[model samples]
Target chain A: MKRKLTIFKIGGRVLEDEQALGAFLKAFSAWPELKLLVHGGGKKATQIADQLGFTPRMIEGRRITDEPALEVALMVYGGLYNKKIVALLQGLGVNAVGLSGADAGLILAQKRPAQTIDFGLVGDVVKIDSLRVHWFLETDLTPVFCALTHDGRGQMLNTNADTIATQLAISMSAVFPTELIFCFEKPGVLAQAQDESSVIPQLNAALYERYRQQKVITDGMIPKLDNAFDALRKGVQKVRITHFNQLKKGTHITLE
Target chain B: MKRKLTIFKIGGRVLEDEQALGAFLKAFSAWPELKLLVHGGGKKATQIADQLGFTPRMIEGRRITDEPALEVALMVYGGLYNKKIVALLQGLGVNAVGLSGADAGLILAQKRPAQTIDFGLVGDVVKIDSLRVHWFLETDLTPVFCALTHDGRGQMLNTNADTIATQLAISMSAVFPTELIFCFEKPGVLAQAQDESSVIPQLNAALYERYRQQKVITDGMIPKLDNAFDALRKGVQKVRITHFNQLKKGTHITLE
Candidate 1:
């Protein structure tokens, strides 16, 4: 039997609030099983970008990471936020190591080829080197990852946090039974758009299609759910969409 | 027999130049030995601090790392520069892991208390945890450390690279016979202030004291030489002050 590895991907909402981040980390540090945390870019990046006078360029609602924008991402995601969390976790007695894919070549990416729109310095995950990750995990160190990867040829690329979480889970599933948890502001996939109390307790592809037909899940939640199901298909033992506070009490997605 | 470990401390002059950095890394990569690198902060930190509109405060020619200044240091020193070098080294086929003292709790520091002037967010090294570092080195991963440390109480502090290098060498000397090399722009300790060819080939405590008395080695070089001698006394096998290119050639400092 393979050991269980829980990979938690937390979004900006929990990270931006000090109390919430502390609470979340306190609970995360208390868990005894091997785990990893992937975090998204927070408002601090955009705020710092604005302060630095670099207006962000977007195409089709996707951030176009220009040179200055990439600088902002590096400073915010890899520096301020990543180190802060690592320090906090250390304070809570969890030996945490902060990482970008570039650190130990843990994750290697390919620059997105230009097509209709030029996505400057964006990357798609091409390879996952789990050796260093395994070494870190086996030594009882929790790895906190930032959403940045590198092309093997020496370019740092901004990657999507959700995609990184999914890729890591899929790859590591070969070595360990992986549980992927996507934590965000909402409790779960809400049955009614604005009602937090209407979280769907369980979800799967067939039910997801019916919910799509019913106009229940739309916009940002759509891509999130798609990624969750894809992880389920890729041999990840379980996928949960939940709030940071409700880690165990979220919508559990499975192949029905 | 004790194994030999080389620790190289490189400054911004070499790191800022692409060709110089690449050459240095190429030479470093070809060497098959247990080695580590500690890098100093660059002007990029100041540039970003200016871009963010934070005027750095200085006292006695030392930077006062106020809250905003500390944030900028974390972003530039720990984030942009550290990861960029790690990626470049990876491109050179050297498996390098970038680290801040917060990562893996490698080094714990105490906040600097105010004497005459408050050096806000500055930390003095209190403890050096070499277990994780030893694990990385033993695993064939060259660890590249930045000049940021944590107080182990959720606060990140800006530290001096030379001091960090000294502390690391002193601490790790217990495990291996260590040689600490300080690499910078100058060829070596110059006999004549502006003459590049006036390299002091050998330096010891007596000669260093004579040079001090003659006012030949004053200012910034004094602290560097002090660190070199301190490391020499702390069981580090050797300490050399050299240019990155002259790694095998420059001034060799000794106690005898």
Candidate 2:
């Protein structure tokens, strides 16, 4: 039997609140199994960008990562927020190490080619250095990753946190019985878009597809659910979508 | 015979210029032995602080690490500068891992107590986890450290990069024949601060003290030279103060 590894991908909302983030980290530190954390950029990045006088470029509701935007991401996501999380975890006696995809060549990415839209420095995940990552786990070091990747050619690229989490879960499943959890503000994938109590506890691919067709699951959540189901198909043992506070209770995703 | 390790501490000035930093990292990558890097923050921190509306508080020519200043240090030193160097080194085919003192509990420090003046969040080095650092070296992972240490109680504190390098050299000397190099903009310690060509080939405690008494060596160089001589008094095998480019040619410091 393979060892158990729990990977949590926390959204920007959880990180934005100091009290919430502190409470979440405290609970996370107490977790007994091997664990890893991947965090998304909060509004702090946008706030810092505005302070730096870099107007965020958005095209058709999609964010564009130009030179200045990338700099903001580097400072906020890779540096400020990431290191803070590591320090807090260390304070809780978790022995945490902060990382970007570029560190130890843990994740390699390709610059997203400009087709219809030019997303300046955005990158798509190309590879995960699973061997090195496994070595870190074996040595009992917990890694906290921010949403940044690097092209092998000396350029840093902004990446989506959810996709990074899914990729990591898929890769590590080969060595461990990996469980991927997506923690956000919502309790889980809600049966009714507005009802918090109407969470569909067990979500499989077929049900997710039906909900997508019925327009029950729309907007930002569609892609996240898609990523979670994809991870299940790619050999990840289990997947959960839950609120940070309700870690064990939210939606459990299965392939069947 | 113990294995050889070369440790370099690059000052803020050397990191200020983009082209110079690129060239320096290129040269550092081509180095064919076990190596590590510790870096100081350049003027970027102050610039960011200005943008963020934090008035830097300095007393007696010493900068105070108040809450705002410490925040700036975390964003600049731990995030922006450290990760950039790590990405660039990775691009150059060196397996670089970026670190702060908080990462893996590598460096433990104590918050400087309030005396005549309270330095806010500034920390003095209390210990170096040389065993963990040696594991990184043995694993073929080159560490790139920013000038931030943490108190084990979960507070990240501002630390001096030169002191970090000196302490690391002293600790690692037990397992490796360590050479400590301080890289700055100037070629080496000079006879006259104004003349670039008056580079001192070798320096010892007696000569350094004589130069100090004559007022030839004054101000900032005093503490740095004192630290170098102190490291020599400890177990560090060799110490040199030189420019990033002229790594081989520098004012070598000796105990005699």
Candidate 3:
């Protein structure tokens, strides 16, 4: 049997709520296997940007990581948010270390060039240094990664947490059977929007495509599901979209 | 022969100057030995404090790390400055990993108790996890530490860079022949107040005390020298105070 590596990505909603974050930490620390945690920047970055007199600009749901916004992201995501999660996990007796992608050259990224939009310092993942991460795992430490990467040429780049989680799962799945979980407020993808109880039990590529064509899973969720299906196709054992409270029970997405 | 470990600590003057920092990084990367870098937070923290609408409070040249000040420290020291150094080192082909004391449980600290002045969120080093650091050293990775520690109970603490360097040197010297170097603008401990050419070549405990009494070395140099001698007495092979440009030629301090 292959060793299991679980990668949990907690979204902004849970990160913004103190009680929920604390509860999630408790639950997360209770697991006795090898795991990694990826956290997204919450309202803190926007608040800091507002205080710094720059209104944060977002294009379609993604942040435009301009110079000032990149600094704010570095401070909030890499400093405040990442350290907070590591400390809380420490208090829970989980030896967690915080990391930006620059640390240990864990992830090498390329600046997203001007395709249709100039995303400034935003980066797309180019390579994942799985050996060092595996070393960290073997050392009995849980790595809590912030949504940041580096361009290898002395630049820190803001990355999306969901993409990072999916990419990490794809890479680590080659070494260990990897399961990726994306946690948010909702229990899972709903059959009908705003209907809490109508959670989809399973999602596959064909059904996901059908739902997309029927406008069932729309807007922000489309990209998230696309990334998850990509992970599924890339040898990740499974990907789950669920609430923080129901991390183990959610809409499990698979190729089969 | 035991392996040689040289830990260089760069102070504010070099950090604040882009050209000097770049030059130092180039020189530092040229060295083909085991090394680590500890960086001090320069005026960046004070600028951040001012921007955040608070006058930075300092007593006897030490920052009073209250809650807001600690947040600023975390952002400046652990976030911007640490990542910048790591990225720059990475660019120079040095695999540098940035760490706060919290990372990998590197340095466990105790909150400084109320002694005369209640410095909030300030930590005194209690233990240094030399084994994990030795693991890094053996793995051929240079650890660049920021001036931040954690209480191991979910609180980040602002610490002094010189003390951190000294403590690390003392702890690691038992395993490796460790040399500690503190870098600043001046060539070394100056014989006169303003004479840059009058660099003191050697400093012993007795000479340091005599110079202090004669008012040749006063103000900020006092605590730095104190930490240096403390490291020497605690088994660090040697300690030097020098300019970044003259890292190899500096005022060597020893207990003898």
Candidate 4:
């Protein structure tokens, strides 16, 4: 039997609220297994960019991470938000270390090539130095990662937090029984979209495809589910999409 | 013989200039002994505070870190500058990890009590977790620390980078033969403040006192020398004040 490792990915909304984030962290600290946190940049980045007089560029609703935008992300995500979370966790008696993928080359990425739309400094995950991560875990330290990676050639790249969590889950599963949890504002993948209570209790690959065909799961959610299924296929023992408060009560993604 | 460890503390001026910082990091990376870095928040913090509409409060030439200022410090120092340095070092083939005193509780501090003038969230170093730092060194990870510490009760406090470097040197010296270097823009402590070339090759307690009596070594240089001497008395093997480029050609401090 392998050691159990639980990974949680929190979106930007929960981070923006002090009380909500504090409550969530309180719960996280009490978790009885090896855990890691990956967080997304909140609206604070956009606000800071505006203050700096840099207009954000977007193509087809996807953020375009130009040089200035990347700096905003670096400051808000990696600096302010990450450190705040680490301090809160420390106060809660959890030994937490904040990290960016560039630290110690923990995550190496390849810059996305410009095609129809060039994502300026965006990167796709190439490899994870799992051994180094394992060292942190074995040393009784919890890692809190922000949505930033590096090219290993001295450039920091903006990365997706959900994708990072999936990749980490897939990679660490080789050594431990890894479970990935995607925490958002919603209760779960709502079956009725309008009704928050109509969450699909158990979502398998077939059900996920059916929901996609039925247009129940579309847009941003498609990629999230795809990443979840990909993690399941790539040896992750379990994956779930749920609300930050209702951690155990969410849509559990299964291979079946 | 104890293994040698070199620690460098760089002030805001070097950090504010990209080219100068790049040059400094190039020299630092080529150093053969085990090493660490501590960095100060440059003018960027004040620039950010102004943009955010917060007036920086200072007393007796010391900046006071109110809540807003503390947030700015967290964003600029812990986030933007620290990550940038980590990525730059990674590019230079050094496995660098960015850190704050909060991360892993590596440095514990006490928030200064409010007296005549409340320094707001500023903290003074109380303890250094030397064993944990040694783990990073043993793991071959170079720590790049920003001037921030936590109260262990969840509050992050602004700190002085030079002081943190001195504390780290004093603590780590027990385990390794540690040397502390304070890198600034000047060549060295000048005998004539107007003459750049009149670098004091070596400084001792006696000469330092004489310079103080003559009022040549006044103001900022006084506290800096006091910290250096304190480290030497505590156990640090050697301490120097120099320009970032002229690491070997600085005013070496001596106890005699």
Candidate 5:
């Protein structure tokens, strides 16, 4: 078998959309050997964060991982959100394993201080290992990694799902030339949100930053792009940001 | 650090009494240097089984986990029961890590074939390594292990919690000298169910058989004794059986 992996990032919208998500997962194994799944649970995280009396914030459209926000992220990313995805795959006859990034030490880092930067308990990925993911794959299982990680100490700090996916994708690509696909509610990388067909066929670093600065792609997309850049820098060949429907198609690199 | 481990056998009764369970977990970590929890969800399992049109049976008072029974077992053991315990601990300032026997290969087993003598997917603990549990304990983290194992294929199968606790206690004993404590609703091993004060202080092989012959210490207790015996035989020196309220006060054994 060729050393190739496909990392599919499913957002909260797709999961909350029960009917579509079920149909999509049911037909997963049929859609080119789906090697790994790096999922994001946006809705659950927000709700849990609110319940915990922590306000979620975004800096440059990326989630600012404040201390409280980190708890919310872990509960959603590791608890509620993680289990739901595992159950879905279970329904679809898949040996879906759910793991917090802390389980196999998937992501490690030096802690960002509680200073002006304000990314409380947040960590930047300094090490990434796909060995645990590989073990699952060898057992004919698909790993659904939750974006919950620890800082080598016992504390659970939150990391962004997009960042988690990028780190994971980069690690996966080191062993297998992989495609990291992120699925959102939108049809694809849209030049115009209202027009579903206005797919931005590809993007380079310069063009991505230009669009971000021009306010063409506001909130959330920026961090995603940053994550995409990180993945590319780490030797990942392909990364796609598109809607759930466009998952089976569209490569994120070609500027069509 | 000496090889001192703690094995907590959490009964289904604890979930029914949520507040008490939570309090107990909070108090449990008072000496959290080494710990692993084995939990049961008989009530939840039975309720789900009944709703799903399954009639649970028992061989010598142990749930005869047929396929249908096993489905409910999964729902209770892995889903509702496991998560609740984890949440309770987390709520009470304990960094309790909940996992099934499948995670980190905590437990390994062989499937009992489907026959008239049905054990369902109920597995015999063929192997268990304390590597992961030890890591958790060393880091002052409490690991709550549910009695769920994967078939090394895609299916998650439910095994008996007592068996899980016994094997785990034995495996970890080499390093942690883990104490195996099984907590139930009833107060201690009763010599007479009607009399709360009839709690047995101690027992030996002969004494256990004598009680069985008299049919006085019957139902559920048999398997527990068998498990205790097996654990002791496998190098685990002590086993405690008690009610939740009398958790700290109960029978302790130093087996031959």
Candidate 6:
């Protein structure tokens, strides 16, 4: 039987970590089934922002990517962060190719103009043209996507990595049953923040809403889970959210 | 009679001037030929370098792009600059698509190891994969390439726009009898820098090297000529170097 394919969301931390990145890439390169990479650049973006004297702001847990921050974010996401991840994987002998949503006109966005509120440089993924991406895939290269996109007319915009992944998955679901496995700094969705014993095995729509009501899903973890469900609802059947430490050791998500 | 195919080299200055960009694109975008766009970002890159407190140094006429400067270069080339060019051309009703060399594994490179004549985030154009590029060309979408490239792993490196244009010309030489045109802020290559009337219409190998000897052809200009010669050497019959102001009629270069 063919191994099921998975899309792994490796954050900037893991991609930049020499040891971790090398190991992750080695495993990925070893896998026979198709795997897609969607990535974020929290670390590199922060570094460049600090150097440029731009203090980044966030709204609703999303980086408040205004103009200056957007400029720096472009440096981080598509340039610094994207290449670093691609290089590390290439070092591990993976045929890894890095990209931003703009390359090959891969992804397009309608400017997310400041709405009732503002998202600044952030964009809603309006369109996905996966042709060039398929070109890389056909050439036996695993695409490591940087979480950046283009406004339909030629502006680069900051977008959430999870959103990039989910959008890609939604489009991909038309061809194959795609799965997204989001690997992060923390273990699987915690029942209790500090207690390893209170592990939640599964989550369903009702339970997710209840958790949302209880405010347990207040931090960065909420968006990741929400993105997972969004992908599931859009047609992807499998999404595994687990800590990087538990990767390749047979980790699973508890969905109700 | 069919209009001769002209390779238009659009400079950053014209791209920065909104009205000029729109007008030029309105005219140039109408051409149906094998058009290659090569551009530079002096103003934006220099501005960001000034803001970041780094001495923007140009070695052998090429910007010495360490990590910080490389970040800035990317903002100008891949982010704001690339999109702006593509968007304006598209707005002019040209089926235009923008690309940074980093995308589609088109431009691959080798990162210089640390402390040993470090090229920073600079890359050599290894291969121009025509698969995706050809698709866009056939579909009537003009490709606007940003002067950025990748190592095919994950690093985005800054390259000269002129060099990219030369290589693309050479690559297309076999298929289309390519011509490389470099558009700059100046009227054209001059025997006298101040005299627009002194534009050199053509150059043979011996004469081209004389310009290189006097250092009048130093800096970015050298690569432009070298690439022109490279294209000719690799089977391209001609390369044109001119100013955007002259693009309506186009310029001519004859190498014998």
Which candidate should be chosen as best, given lDDT against the real structure? Answer: 4
Name the regions of candidate 3 deviating beyond 4 angstroms.
A57-62, B57-62
Off by over 4 Å in 1: none
Per-residue alpha-carbon lDDT of model 4 for A62-123, expressed as tens digits?
Answer: 88999999988988998899999999999999999999999989999989999998988999
Question: Which structure is stronger by DockQ: 1 or 4?
Answer: 4
lDDT of candidate 6? 0.69
Between 3 and 6, whose lDDT is larger? 3
lDDT of predicted model 5: 0.69
List-wise, what DockQ does each model earn?
0.81, 0.80, 0.71, 0.86, 0.10, 0.32
Model 6 lDDT at residue A3? 38
Mind giving the per-residue lDDT tens digits that candidate 6 earns over A81-144? Answer: 5655665565556766666676556677766778666778777888887665555566676887
Docking class of 4: high
Give the top-scoring candidate (DockQ).
Answer: 4
Give per-residue lDDT, candidate 5, residue B165.
90
lDDT of 3 by residue, B1-256 (tens): 6689999999877888889999999999887779999999989888877877877778876568788888888888888788888888888898899899998889889999988787889899999999999998899789999999998888888889999999999999988999999999889999897999999999999999999999999998999999999999999998999999987997999887
lDDT of 1: 0.90
Docking category of candidate 1: high
Query: How big is the positional error of residue A236 in model 3, measured in Å on the Cα after superposition?
Result: 0.3
lDDT of 2 at A172: 95
**Over all chains combined, what TM-score does candidate 4 have?**
0.98
lDDT of model 6 at position B168: 73
lDDT of 3: 0.89
True contacts kept of each: 0.77, 0.70, 0.57, 0.77, 0.01, 0.32
Model 2 lDDT per residue over B126-167, tens place: 998888999999998999999999998878999999989988
lDDT (Cα, 0-100) at A123 in candidate 4: 90
TM-score of each: 0.97, 0.98, 0.97, 0.98, 0.63, 0.82
- Candidate 4: segments with Cα more than 4 A from true spot: B59-61
DockQ of model 3 vs. true complex: 0.71
lDDT of 5 by residue, B1-256 (tens): 4666768787777877867776667667565456667887767666545644568878766567666666555545654456456545554556666676665455667687767676666777777757656765666567787777655544456778888898888998877666788887777888897888988887776788888899987877899988887788778867888876666776665464
Q: Each model: TM-score of chain B?
A: 0.97, 0.98, 0.97, 0.98, 0.88, 0.86
